[model samples]
Target chain A: MSFQPVKFYQTGTFTVGNRLLPPEERSVQAQTKRFNSINSGHRACQGCGEALGARYAVDAAMEAANGQLICANATGCLEVFSTPYPETSWQVPWIHSLFGNTAAVATGIAAALKVKQLKGERRDIRVVAQGGDGGTTDIGFGCLSGMFERNDDVLYICYDNGGYMNTGIQRSSATPPAARTATTLAVGDEPGNLFGQGKFVPAIAMAHEIPYVATATVADLRDLEAKVRRAMAIRGARYLHILVPCPLGWGTASHETIRIARLAKETGIFPVFEAEHGELKSVLAIRRPLPVEDYLKPQKRYAHLFAPKARLEVIARLQQLADRNIRRYGLLEGN
Target chain B: MLKQIEGSRAVAEAVALCRPEVICAYPISPQTHIVEALGEFVKDGTLAPCEFINVESEFAAMSVAIGSSAAGARTYTATASQGLLFMAEAVYNASGLGLPIVMTVANRAIGAPINIWNDHSDALSQRDSGWLQIFAETNQEALDLHIQAFRLAEELSLPIMVCMDGFILTHAYERVDMPTQAQVDAYLPKYEPRQVLDPAEPVSIGAMVGPEAFMEVRYLAHAKQMEALKLIPGYAAEFREVFGRDSGGLTHTYKADDAETMVVAMGSLLGTIKDVIDEMRAAGHKIGVLGITLFRPFPIAQVREALHGAQRVVVLEKSLAVGLGGILATNVRMALSALPIDVYTVVAGIGGRPITMRSLHALFREAERDDIDPVTFLDLNHDVVDKQLARERSTRRSGPAAEAILRDIGVVAAKVAQEVR
Candidate 1:
C-alpha cells in the first residue's frame, strides 16, 4: 500500500468541513446524505446545545453503525424536547426510560444484540446511550459507572451543558465553579457553585479503564463526529463527554452557543482529549489559547465575578484552574 | 421430573426453561441463590446464548431488563425487600413501557430494623406499578408461576412479578415436579416482542407522555391488566395440560364450596392457612381457605364469587399498611364492597414473624364465630407494643421506636449489656 498525504483545510478555525477534503474524510454533518437520527421538530429552546450535540453525535453514530443503531436516552432536556407523547423527533429506534438508568438500559440492548448475534439473527447492531449533565454526573452517575465498570458494549454520551437547563438551571455535579444556577445562586459569600464541587466525568470514565473515552464540544462538530465514529468502531464500553453550551442556562444569545463552546475549548477551561484503556492517546491542542475571561465573560452565569467591583481573586482562581488543565493535558502546542 | 430442590434453584431452573435471553442479577437475600444458580447455568453452557449480567444494584438489574426486554430479548431478574424498593422506579418504568419482562420478587419485609425473612411487603409495595403480580404458594407453585408469568407477560405486553415468600419458599427445599424443556417450550412460546427496538422498524418507545395522553396511556396499562384477568386462566389451563399440575389461577379454593367462613390469604402463608383450615374443618367448623394466586388486577369478580357464599370472610396477609390496616385486606374489601359481607382484615406474619398453625386455627375459629376484630394483628405481643406506646406518650423523644421495642423485648445487646452493667 502506498502512502498518501491528504491535504487538510481550515485547520485553525472551528470549521467542520472544507471542500478540499475528500468525501470519505469529510465530517458526517457536512455530507448531504447524513442521517438526521434526531430529526427536526424538536421543542428545544433557542440555541439548545444538547439538541445540537445529540443530533451531531447520534447521526455520526448512526453513520458509523451503517444505520443500525438504537439509542437509550436519559430523562433530560434531550429526551423531553425530542419526545413528547403523540409526537417524536427521533428517526431511529430510541427509548427514553428514566433520568438515571440510560447506561444500564443501553447495556441491556447491547446484551440483547449480543444474544441475537450469537443466535445468528442480527449482526453488529450498536447501542448508544445519551444523557444530560444532571443525568450523567449526578443521579445517573451510579448506573453510568456501573456500565463502565462492567465494560458493557455501550457508548455513553454526556451532553454537559454545565447545569440542569431543562429543570430551570439547577446546579448539577457538572456545574462549573462560580457559574450561577438556580440552586447555586449568585448571592452567597461564595457566590455561584462551589469551586471544589462538580465532577469531570470523562476522567472518572477513563479511570474505569474502558476501551475508549473522549471529550468534545459542540463548537467543533468535526471533532465531535470523529469521536463518535471512533467510539462506535470500538467494542466494549466507551464514553464521550461533549461540552454543550446552553444559551438559556448561560444567559447568552442564541447565536452565541457555538461561539461560547469555541471559547470554552480555546480558553483551556475544557481540555479536549481522547483516552484508551486509561491511557491518554491524544489532545486537541489549543489553536489560539485565550484567557479564561473570554469564555466566562459572555455568559451571565459568571456575570457575578465581573460585577460589583471585580472579584479578582475568584477570577484568578478560575484562571488557575484552567491553567492547571492546560498544563495537565499539554493543551499548548510545543509546550 | 420429581426432584427435591431449593425453591430458588427450582425457580431458576424454571426461568432457564423459559429460555430467557438476558438475566440480570444483583445479590439480595433470598433472591441471591436464584441468580447464582442462573449464573452457573449460563457459565456451564446449560443456558446457551443467555447473557447473565451481575449488576451493581437492583436498579441496574431492572433497568437492564427493561433495555433487553425492549430490544426483543426475554429478560428476567430477581430481587427482594430493599432491592425491590431500590428498583421501584425501573419497575414502574418497565410496566409503563409495556415490556414483557418477568421478575422474581423473593418477597421479604421492608425494614426499619432490617429483617430479611419471608413476607409479602416487597411485592405488595409495587401492587399498583402496572405489573401483573401473582403469588406462589409453594416451591412447585413458584416454579410453575414463573413459567406462566413469562407467557402471560409476553401475551399482554406487560411485566409480571412472581412473588414467592423469601426464605419460606426461596430458602426451603421441597420436592417439585420440574417440567422438561419440551413441556415449557410447549406452554411458553418463543418471545415475539410486540414492540422492539429494530433498525428496520424504527419507533420511539418510553416517550414522555403529557397530560393529554398520559391518562389514556395509564388506562391502557390498566386495560391490559384487566385483559390479563381474562387470559390467566386459559394460560393456566394450558400449563396444566402441558405440565400436569394445577398451580396458578386467580384464586385456588380448598373446601370452600359450601363453607360459611372463607379465610383468604396470599403467598406461602396459604400453605399454613390451608393446614389450619383442614384442622378447623376436622373439628366440625365450616371454614375453608381461599388462596389468592394472582393478587394484582385484584381478581374482583373471582374473589367476590369465591367469598359471596360465605357468611363472613377473613383476609390473612403478611403485609401491613401501618397507619391504615392491611394492604391485601383493603383490596379484599374493595372486591366485596358491593356485597354485605363482613371481611375481616388479619394482618399477620409481619417482618418475618412466623404464622404458626396454632395461631391461625384460633384466628379462624374466632372468625367463624364473627367474634374477631375487623382488623386483627395475629400473635402480636401487646405487652411490648403497650410499653412502646406508653414510652412515646410519656417521653417527648421516644428514642427510635424500633430500638425501644427491641429494648423492651431485650432483643438488642446494647440494652442487655446496659442492664447487666
Candidate 2:
C-alpha cells in the first residue's frame, strides 16, 4: 500500500450528489443535462447490462448526430424496463418495436428521413435500432439481413451481454461456451453452455460488406463514444456489437462493471475490432493477453468451470477459441 | 361519391387520403391486398411525402411503424392472422412506448389446422395491448375507421388498430363514400407529434426503467385508454362536423328501445345479426341488436346504458375464449354485471367460417331456448364426438378390430380424440 491514504471519503454519496465530482470527471449518466439520452426512471434490474449499454450507446449516438437521433428499440429488457405502462425514462424520440425487428424499424426511419430531405426539410437525422443478442441473431435475423442487403441508411447496434439477460437470464445463441444460464445449465459431461454453439454476429455483420462494422465493450468509455461518432459518419447499414456485462445476471460485483468488461476484451475471448466491407480495418489489440481463466473466474456464470482441477480442458478450449479469434482478425500485430 | 371498392382497397385509399408520413408493412394473406395497394400508391407518387417500407415480415412491419412514429412521423401499417401473431411483441411495444401508430388489422383466425378466413380472434387477441382498437362493420366503415383511427391515435398518443373481418370485408366489394383529400385534410389534421426527434431539445424516448417505476408506467397507459372514452365522442363530433360523415367512430345503437332480448355483435357479423333481429321482431320475438364498433375501450358506460332496458342480452362473437367462452361475452358480462340482465355468449365464425344469415337465426333460437347455457360455442361440428369415441376405444384396445378400423379411416381418425374436447 503506497500510503495513498486509506481515504474513506464518500463523494456526494447519492444520485444527484455526483455534482461534487467536477463537471468533467462526473459519470456521463450523472450529468443533469447529460443527453439523458437514456433518461431516468426505468424498470431495469439493479445492474442490468442492456440498460448501461443503451445509455452509453444512445447518448453517444445523440452526440454524434448532434442530438438528432431517432432510436428503434426491439422488444426486450430495454423496451420493457423503459416503457412499462404510461411513463417512460426515454427523453429522446424513441420507439419500442417487436423483438427481432429493430433493424427494419431503423430502415423505415431512415426512409422517412430521406423523404423529408426530398421535401426540402433538410433534416440531417440519423437512425439507430437496438436489441439483445437473441433479437439480433435469431428472431429478427431475416429483417437485419434484409436491411444489410438493402444498405438502408441506418446504424443497427446489438448490445450483447452474452445471453438474454431479461426474461430470467435465459440462454441465447450468443451465449458463450461453458457459461451456465437458466436454460443452459452446467450439467452433463462437458456441461454448461456447449462448445461449437452460438454465433459471432460481428463477424457475420462484417461479411455483409456494409460501410462500417465494429465490436466494442462498455469498459472503454471514450472508445465506445468515438466508435459511435465514426459509425454516424457513414450512411448505410452499419453494425455495432457492444459487450455490456450484466452484474446482476452475470453474478459479478456491481462496481466491477467497467473492470469486468475490460478483462473480457483483454483476455482475447471477446476481440475488440472494426471492419469495413469484410476487411478488418483496425483492432483494439490487447497489450498483454491474459489467461482466459483470469476473466472467467471473476463472474459466477463461469464458476462451475473453475472447480475440480480448475477444468484446464475447458479453460484451454476457451483460450483456443480466443486464440482463433485473435488469429482470424489479426487482433494483434504481425498479421 | 360512391365507388366499387374491395375492403382492402378502401382501407388503402383511406390511408392515402389520410396522408401518413410513413407506411411500413409486410405481406400476409388477407392483409396482402391492403399493403400492396398502399405500396402501389407510394411507387406511383400518389401517396406523396410518404416513406413506403417493404419490411421482411409482419414483425418488422410493426417494428418499423414504431420507429417511424417515434421519429415524429404519422405512421400506418396492416397485418392479419399469423402475421399479427408474429408482430404481437411490436404491437405491445408501440402502445407501451406511446407512439401514435395507426395499424389496420384485417382480422382473421389463428390456425394450427391452417386456416385463412374472417374472424375476430386475431384482433381480439391483442385487446389488452394498450392500443385503441376499433372494429368496422362494413367496407365503408373500414375506410372511415382508418381516417378516424389516426385522429384518435394522435389525440391519445396511443397506437390504434382498425380491425376489419378478413375476406368478408377485405375481399368483398362495396360502395363507400370515399372522402376527398381536402375533406380528409379538414377532418384529420396533419400529424404534429407532441414528442419529436429534435436535436435542440435532446431527450431519450425509450430509456430502461427499473421495477420501481415499471408498474406506474403501465398504469398511465391504462389511464389513457380510460381517458379515450371522453376523447372518442369529442373527436367523432368534430369529424362529423367537418366531413358530414361520422359512422364507425364508436359503438352503434340499433333497435334497443323496449326490447326484451338484444343481440350484441361486432365486425361484419353485425349485419347478419341485424337481419336476424328484424326477422325475429317481425315474428313478434321482441328482439333488438347492438353493434360494437370500438372494442378496446370496451365502451362500458355506453354498453350499460344501451342494454339498460333489455332483460336478456346475447353476445355474438367470432372468437372463443377456449377454456372460458366468448371474448365479447366475457366483456358484456363484466360490463352489465351490476344490472339484472341474462347474458348469453355465442362464439362463431372462428377460422373464417362464414356466419350465414341462417346460422344467426339458429343463434337467436338458441338464445330463446329455455335450457340454453349462458355460454355456447357455435359452429361446433357435432360429428366430432362420434369420431372421438371411435378413436379412443380403438386406441385403448389395439386389437385386429382397431387396426382394421384405423386402415379404413383417414388422418382425421388419428386426431378424433383431440377434436372431441
Candidate whose DockQ is highest:
1
Question: What is the per-residue lDDT of model 1 for residues B1-421, given as tens digits with 9 covering 90 to 100?
Answer: 9999999999999999999999999999989999999999999999999999989889999999999999999999999999999999999999999998999999988887798888888898999999899998899999999999999999999999999889989999999999999898888888888999999999999887778788898999999899988998998888889888787989988899789999888988877888877787888888888889988888999988889888999999898888988999899888888788899999998877767777777888788778999889998889999998999899997799987787668755564354335
What are the candidates' C-alpha RMSDs?
A: 3.4, 7.1
Q: Tell me chain A's TM-score in each of the predictions.
A: 0.95, 0.88
Q: Please identify model 1 stretches exceeding 4 Å from their true place.
A: A1-17, B411-421
Q: What is candidate 2's CA lDDT for residue B26?
A: 81
**Docking quality (DockQ) of candidate 2:** 0.37
Worst 10 residues of 1 chain B by lDDT: B411-420
Q: State in Å the error of residue B59, model 1.
A: 0.7
lDDT, model 2, position A307: 77
lDDT of 2 at B393: 79
**Candidate 2's chain A scores what TM-score?**
0.88
